[model samples]
Target: MSDHSNNNNSWHLSIVERKFLLLWCDFIIVFGAIFLAVILRSTISMDLFLQRGYFGIIFLYTSLTVAIFYIIDLYNIFLIDFWTSIVPRIFIGVALTSLLVIVSSFFLEFLALPRKSIVFMSVVIILGMMLTRYYLMIVKRYPLNIMVLGSGFAALKMIEDIKKSGSAYFHIIGIYDDDDRKHGKEVMEIPIRGGIESFAADIKELRPQMVVVSFEKEIKETWTDILLQCARSNVQVSSAVDIYCKLFGKVPSDHIDALWLLSGIQLIRKPYFIFKRFCDIIFSLIGLFIMLLIFPFVFVIMKITSPGPIFFSQVRVGLNGSHFRIHKFRTMVVDAEKRTGAVWATKGDNRITAFGKFMRKVRIDELPQCWNILKGDMSIVGPRPERPEFVDMLKERITFYDERHLVKPGLTGWAQVLYPYGNTIEDATEKLHYDLFYIRNMSVFMDMKIILKTIATVIGGRGGM
Candidate 1:
């Protein structure tokens, strides 16, 4: 398709409106999966048609499952990088659904459904849901067209960065800069369109989708004309930092300023905190029920093989530096810390018991923290809680370290899943970048993304401590 650069009079959905449309699309896909599952189970010649109450039973079960998916933030129109990470999460969701059906068979008083039917339905639903997301990616025309207003090394670096991003649908039309020396040259096959003097006029003339002001310093005065033109003509505009987050999936560490970090929007709001706590309670209860069901098996195995308590409690710093007892299934030896105080866990650490090693690898030890979530000291998703000892040292070592305590800690976090467990000041610094990214862009949608990444991390044993 030709670029709609000159379509000045055309109407485009605002970002918020587009997000709502994607949400509606998600709802459609979920219900469609329900219908598809039914058709698969009943269309076979070996089976007679379902009875009158059959559809009602199916509807109720489907509704509950859909609600769970919604609560998991599966409906959010994930930003480009986030969308690419959806595959393994889809697998886990299907596995959990199958497990739920199997467990329900023992308690619910519904008519017996064939086990084969349930299994087939789950497989079909998983495939259907994944394909639906890919299809919607096409239809939604996502990853808006982006135009960079620079042609220097920084601009080229931006293109290279986008090259590594799998989730965005970015189409860089060309570059524009003030450097006449590099005017007609092609850097990375993206031609230099023009210089800064004509930048606004070029943008207004071309009316490209989005203008990325990528100059090194603040260009507020220079951007006024182009910003006005873009605003009036329906093109979106963003700063370098904004585009970096959209393209790279994480914030650039060098671009952050103290003022921006301390701004009004960065501060926590009362209602947001309340809502986050509410979410922690609701999900923790559900998670607790699942943990309780599995406790008998886990407890029995640990008791028979090990010589320590089933639950391990440690003092961890919570919101605003408050102390709380964090619970987990003991994943290390009783005296692991006797000789070495507060050393980070390494692969094949001798202190880890055999069962503890497995628990750590699979993250089953974290299951009990649903209780912490219930206690309001933690969230299902946020910055990983650090021990007081580590916090004290890190507070002095890492910049903006205490800022993470602005919100409650979490069970699984952006840092935990994206990066390895912190072993040193360097690792913690890298993690801090991801944590800042999470805090800046925190939302129900982002929380879901981290949760999904956490699932992948567990399954693949990736980035483990």
Candidate 2:
């Protein structure tokens, strides 16, 4: 086996590295903005500010601003245009952050800053972020040159996803496969340069920053030699799965096999489980309290509009493939499924009442699931629980479908936020890719990111059925 770990850090930066760089840049910008704001307002000296314990407050504000920017997708370097997508989100993030800071200052006297200083700080932060992003846009405009080492289906799919990503982060320069017949042919417009024998010459000529080994089967000795040579030359060599997951934020369910699943999946640590459970309990209690406050209004509306039970409950597949009743505010007519039996909800379904449609769009229908989360039947963030009927049917057709049950189901999930409401087997397969990715990379930070995305989804009303 070629020592893949030797060249882990290469000239080319992965998606995670780029994101981390952007995060640090924003953190610096926030700190600088605070300094400039204090100077411009001339209201507080740096020494006095620190002496008064305002440094902690400033740190909190800076952290909150960066987090808001992240939640608003300002850190999404994959966005092609800075003006079209990034600029507006920057303004929204700053505004939201300012609002939060102002609200927080009212409750905590020590957190308060002068009005002029706050305004100046917000303006400086926005300008600083825009300039920083513009610089990154120019710097990352040249996509990383990737020389693929296979012309198989996996390589083709990887190419397709790179194009679909809408960012100039990766450019497939050429492909080299062992098959004699595939030579001189094109896979999705990328030429198959030659067999593995020609890889050395091609590497020198093309001078790619990364070589992606995408073979569908075990690597031959010749290919292994090529990978070792690439490693010696300081060119990054990665499996197609690594590149795909890094770029697309999801696993390639179709390409991954049993060995990949067994080896790649990380066992959930006890601390993560405990932390997740604690969050689930606390957030669920808060959510249920909010639900209680609004229940009477929802109940009256359902009574008037749909003439049905206020709460809808159904059997769902939970952790370990066990069954549990999931509760939701009734968004459909009573006995809506009597004639049709169990089925996926479709867009603009006739069964959904007007109020129910509104509820679903805003995700108000999902609040009742907090009770389930509170009861430990679900999590605040995980794979969305599926109906037992659908789960049973999907497990038969989908590979590794049962693996999703290893973690508890959630009120909102990585799949639920990233993919649209799934109604077909194909959609379910696509979602499984995200769910598996979540399972393999489960962490408190990942869960927090999912929760932030879920909030964005609810506000945007773009992902519901």
Candidate 3:
């Protein structure tokens, strides 16, 4: 949810839902501008843009551009201030989309649109997108104005997330608690206001569209009565836990109690796993094809660089806590771990050869992982497989660490693509949060997104080690 929202764009909906609306809004604007350009240039009616002949090209362009935007992090809703940072990325994405179209035109005979039209369409899309983005930014049209009701740890975490999100569509009025010490205090610079003594009056005066309750312990029975009364008067009452899940894709680590872990049991969807395996087979073949093509070049480089085997295999933890040998183009010195046994890769580790660094940077080292996918040892998208040495330590030190193995391991995954290279227990814990989020929200669309994003991450030469 930090990166994307579901399709619903309602204000009362969580952070992800509203951002999903914003994403679609972005798609529409970009596509609309292209349609507008075609109409103005070719003198066609608006409906004509959707005609069979025109629609194919229109869909391709819009979809590619939007995908490029996502790859460049245009939809990272958690960024503190994105507008100032997004212009160059937007420019690069626009250029890349145009270049793709131009390149494809040589092979696809139907793509022979006039150069002027293409140029004009790009101009219109860029202008329209910019104008629309700025307009949305300047607008104060949030559908949800929520008042957080609590002064406990949960309340503080909720406040912290909301404050960090920089969401234009969500307004947090203030936190309310009954503790006398916090009645007039400020948390995150927002007034704590009055406690239970003035809760009803404050709600009435602020007229929040929703109330989120995150008290660590149950509030007074009288306060619950008042909350129910406020709900009856048209104010929505929502759980802080649910709101937290909506804002962040993962459950809050601190709030992962018994019920939360038990609730995750329902996420094991058999049908989805079947479909996911199908994807793994298809994509793994494609990856193997690419790997085969580059085999000779990599082989020669490996032979010339380090005195080691071209491929290396390591035992990694996989589904249901099973272990499998994972294959990768060797990117470390021969017997690199002989002295240290099993140690984490360090930043700029001297054990890595020049070719190894290049291979890791561009992710060519992972090409052999396609074999793992083909062999049913991993998925195309899921949690990254870890070594038994690390897994055992992680399980002992990190909460819910074993849950990642409940699903199939992956070649490139949510954790692999989203998080930086993790070399310590703390880093592993952060990656686990992202891994858990992926497991809970596993879907066809989400998998495709992770794959697409992995492509971008690889191309950017930046990703976890």
**TM-score of every candidate:** 0.66, 0.80, 0.76
What residue runs in model 1 are displaced by over 4 Å at the alpha carbon?
A: 1-78, 81-144, 150-158, 166-168, 178-194, 204-206, 262-269, 282-306, 309-311, 392-398, 420-426, 448-465
Q: Which digits, one per residue and each the tens of the lDDT, describe model 3 over residues 110-217?
A: 444578877876786677666655555445343356788886676678778776776655666777877788777777876777777677886765566678888878
List where candidate 3 sits over 4 angstroms from the true fold.
1-130, 138-144, 161-171, 219-236, 261-269
Ranking by TM-score: 2, 3, 1
Instruction: Say which prediction, candidate 1 or candidate 3, comes out ahead on TM-score.
Output: 3
Judging by TM-score against the true structure, name the best candidate: 2
Q: How accurate locally is residue 45 in candidate 1, as Cα lDDT from 0 to 100? A: 41
lDDT of 3 at 226: 88
Model 1 lDDT tens row, 65-149: 6666656556544345334555655665667666766677677434234777666667777767777666656554444455787
Q: Following a full C-alpha superposition, what root-mean-square deviation does model 3 have from the true structure? A: 6.8
Location of the lowest summed lDDT over 10 successive residues in candidate 3: 1-10
